[model samples]
Target: MAGIELRKVVKNFGKTQVIEGISQSVPDGTFLVIVGPSGCGKSTVLRLIAGLEEVTSGEIFIGERDVARLEPKDRDVAMVFQNYALYPHMSVRENICYGLKVRGLPKAEQERRLALAADMLGLSEYLDRSPRQLSGGQRQRVAMGRAIVREAAVFLFDEPLSNLDASLRNQMRVELRRLHERLGTTSIYVTHDQVEAMTLAQRIMVMNQGHVEQYGTPDELYLSPATVFTARFIGSPNMNMLRASLERGRLKLPGGTFLPPIPATDAAFTGRAGEILLGVRPEDLLPAGENAPETLRCRVELVEVLGADTLVHCALPNEAEGQEPIIARLEGSSRPGPGDVIHLGIRHGKAHLFDPVTKKRLAV
Candidate 1:
C-alpha cells in the first residue's frame, strides 16, 4: 500500500477556478473520504489524484514518487466510477481478469486472481453472466472485483453505490467496510452523502465552494464543530440554530435560557459581549415536562415518526423570521404527536456557541 499526498492542488476550467489550493495527505492503508455538496469539486479532486487531470499548480505524490506528469496507468491506482463501467460483451470472469491480461500476466496467474476476487465478492456463482444480465448491485460488485484483483497501491471510489436502492446501499456499505479491513489498501472515496461518510470514513474532508470547510473524525466534527456550517452539515435533521446574547454569564435567547459560561469557553468570551449563534443537535433537546430546571417554552409544530425515534418540529416564541424551525429528536415511545403542548429542555453541557460575526465556535 502507498500513501497519497496533494500539495497546494488547484484545478480550473477555462477561466473559472473549480478547485482552490487544497493540500491533504492520505496515510498508507487509510480510508479517507472526500465529501461535499454537488458542484463542490469532489470528483475533480479524485481525478487529480488519479492523474486523469493535470494539476494547475501543485504536486501529486504516491509514496515517494511525483506522479503529476505520469499517466493514469503508471500511477498504480484503481478507480471505480459511479456508473459501473463494465464491458457489456465480457463475462464476469473475463471482466475481472481484463487488467491482468493487459499487463501481460500469464494466463494461469490471471485465472488465479480472477477466481480469488470472484470468490471473495460472491461473483463466483455467476462468472459466466454478462454485465447486461446482472443486477445493479451485482454489476457494482463486478466493478469492485475488477479493482480488487489489481491489488493497486491505492483505490479511488467515485460514489460507486449511488445508483443502488436503499437496502442495497446499506448492504454494500457493510461489505465495503469488510473488504477494506481485509485489504487495507489506501483508499480515497468521494461522495455527497454524509451518512456514507460517517459510516465508512476514518476521517472526512468536508468541501464547500472550492475549499475545505472542515476536516476531522466523525465525532469531532459532530460534537465540537469549529464553525456554524459544520454543525449543520454533519448531523441528521441538522442542528438547530438560535440567535442569542450573553447576559450575566448566561446565554439569553427568545424562548429559553441557556447554561452559564462553558468551563472551557470563559477565556474566549472574556469581556466580549454581543450577538452569538447557539447550536444544539436534535438529540440534545428533550420534552420539557421532565422538569429540568432549565427549559424552553415552544409550540409543537409537527412530528415525524422514523422507526425507533421521532423528530419534533417546534416554533419558539423568539424564533427569528425566515430562520428554519427548531427540531428535536425524542424516543418514539414517549414522543407526542402534532399540536401537543409540551415544555422542552436543552442539554446544557451539549450546547455550542459560535461568534455571530466570524461564525467560528467559541473556544469552549
Candidate 2:
C-alpha cells in the first residue's frame, strides 16, 4: 500500500480550467472519497491521480516518488471504471488473467493469483462464463478480480457502482468495504452520490466547481459543515435556510418572530450581528406545544408518510415571497394533515448560523 499526495494540482483544457489548485493527502491504506455534484471535476481528480490525465501544473506523489509525469502503466494503481471495461469475447478467467499475461508472470503464478481473486470475489463458479452470460453485478466482480490480480498499491474507482440497480449497488457497497478491509489497499473513489461517500469513505473531500469545499470525516461534514453549500449538500432532504437578522443577542426571523439568544457564550454572538442565514436540519425541527416559547406558526402544505418517519411540509405566515416551504422530519406516528396549523421550534443548539455574504458557517 502507498499514500498519495497532491500539491496544488491543476488541470486545464485549452482555456477552461477544470481543476483549480487542489492539494490533499491520502494516508497509506486509507479509503478516501471525492464527492460532489455532476461537473464538479471529481472524476478529473481521480484521472489525474491514476495518471490517465496529465496535470497542467503542480506535482503528484505516490509514496515518496514524484509520479506527475509517469505513464498509467508505470503508476502502481488499478482502476475500475463505470462501464466495467471487460472484453466480452473472453471468459472471466482469461479476462482477469490478461494483465498478468501482459506483465509476463509465470503461468503457475498467474493461476495462483486468479484462484485467489476468484475465491475472494465469489466468482470461482463463473470463471468459464463469458461477460455476456453473467449478471451486471457478476460482471463487475470480474472487473474487480482483474484489478485484484495486479496487486497494485492504490485502487481507483470511477463510479464503479453507478450502473447497478439500487439493491445491487447496496450489496456491492458492502462487498467493496469488506474487500478493502481485508486487503487494506489505498483506494480513491469518485462519485456524485453523497450516500456512497458517507458509507464508504474514511475521509471525504467535498468538491464544487473545480474546488475543494471541505475535507473531513463523514460525521464532521454532516454535523459541522464548514460552509452553507456543504451543509445543504451533505444531508438528506437538504437543510432549511431562513433569512434572518441578529441584533442584541436575539435573532429575528423573516416573519417577525424573535428567537431567544442562542447560547449566550457562542462566539458568533460576541459582537457579530447582521443579516444571517439560519440553517436547521429537517430532523431538528420538532412540533411545539401551544404555549411553547420561540415557536413559528406554520400552515401544513403536505405530509409524506415514510416507513419510519413523516415529512411535514409547511409555510410560515408572512414569509418571504417565493421561498420554499420548510420541511420537518418527524416520527411516523406524528401525523399533521394539510391545512392544519402547527407550531415548530428549533432544537436547542441544533441551529447553525452563517454569514449571509460569505455563506460560511459562523463559529459557535
Winning model by lDDT: 2
Give the alpha carbon lDDT tens digit for every residue of 157-200 in model 1: 99999999999999999999999999999999999999999999
Candidate RMSDs in order: 1.8, 1.3
For each candidate, give its TM-score against the true structure: 0.95, 0.97
lDDT of 1 at 53: 90
Model 2 lDDT-worst window of ten: 264-273
Candidate 2 stretches with Cα past 4 Å from truth are 318-324
User: Candidate 2, residues 1-364: lDDT per residue as tens digits?
Assistant: 7999999999998999999999999999999999999999999999999999999998999999889999988889999999999998999999999988988999999999999999999999999999999999999999999999999999999999999999999999999999999999999999889999999999999999999999999999998899999999998889998888887778888788898668842555867678999999999998899888789778899999997999999987656684447999998999999999888999888888888989998877
List ranges where model 1 is wrong by over 4 Å: 256-261, 290-293, 319-324
